[model samples]
Target: MKRNLSSFAHPVCATLAVGALAVLSGCSSSAPLFLSDGRATTLVQCPVGSDSCSQQASASCGGAYDVVRQSSASGTLSLIYACRAK
Candidate 1:
């Protein structure tokens, strides 16, 4: 007796396609990495004595987070931050 295989092919193909899409999407950098407490954080450095330093740092924090700390050393200013969600 010969067994038919076409009936199972579509589901297998669809499953593979979905699995591939999930894997590909997981590799994207657009997604933010959040901490266990649901906050996202990053470090930003800028040149001291520049008015744009704070602006650039805020932009680097994705424009939603607040500047938690600001420090300067040598000629650079550093910003530590966490995102503020609505």
Candidate 2:
């Protein structure tokens, strides 16, 4: 009896192909990278203000000095940061 390719083909091989494609697509995503050039950058933790927005704003930039917490970003600045860990 002849075998069906779909049924005979290895499921693991198909799964690996799909996973590889997903990883490739993720690398091409236009989101954001956590760090740059590998330097010690300061993520300014601005003081909480009267408007109650200060806490929110600072929370946005909460991670290491360069980490982003908020949606809106300001002027670009040079940063000397390590692969990670600010």
Candidate 3:
């Protein structure tokens, strides 16, 4: 006799999907990355159609900053940068 397995599949798959999403969300650029020398790289997010992200990065660094990487997704722009030392 074959046991009915459909009843258990949906909940298990849903639980696993949610757990995976939670783990992946931590990988987003919202978190800051610190260098070995104590210099920290910040992530600045703004609307994709504006210069706000770059301006924000400059403000965060208090002067100038180097862009480590940048990407735009879902109408949001993400900029990862490290401030230049004075």
* Top lDDT prediction, candidate number: 3
Clashing residue pairs for model 2: 38-81, 38-82, 39-80, 39-81, 39-82, 40-80, 42-65, 43-65, 60-69
State the lDDT of candidate 1 residue by residue for 1-86, as single tens digits. Answer: 77579888999999999999999999887655566678876667878888665676556655666766789999998876776775
Supply the TM-score for candidate 2.
0.27
lDDT of 2 by residue, 1-86 (tens): 88788775788688999999999998893633444464433333232333234433344446333333433235333222222343
Which rank order by lDDT, best down to worst?
3, 1, 2
Candidate 3 CA-lDDT value: 0.87
For residue 10, what is the lDDT in candidate 3? 92
Better of 1 and 3 by lDDT: 3
Candidate 3 global Cα RMSD: 5.5
For residues 2-85, write the lDDT of model 3, one tens digit per residue: 757998899999999999999999888664688766678888799999999888888888889888889999999998899988
**Which residue segments of model 3 deviate by more than 4 Å?**
1-31
Better of 2 and 3 by lDDT: 3
List the candidates' TM-scores in order. Answer: 0.46, 0.27, 0.58
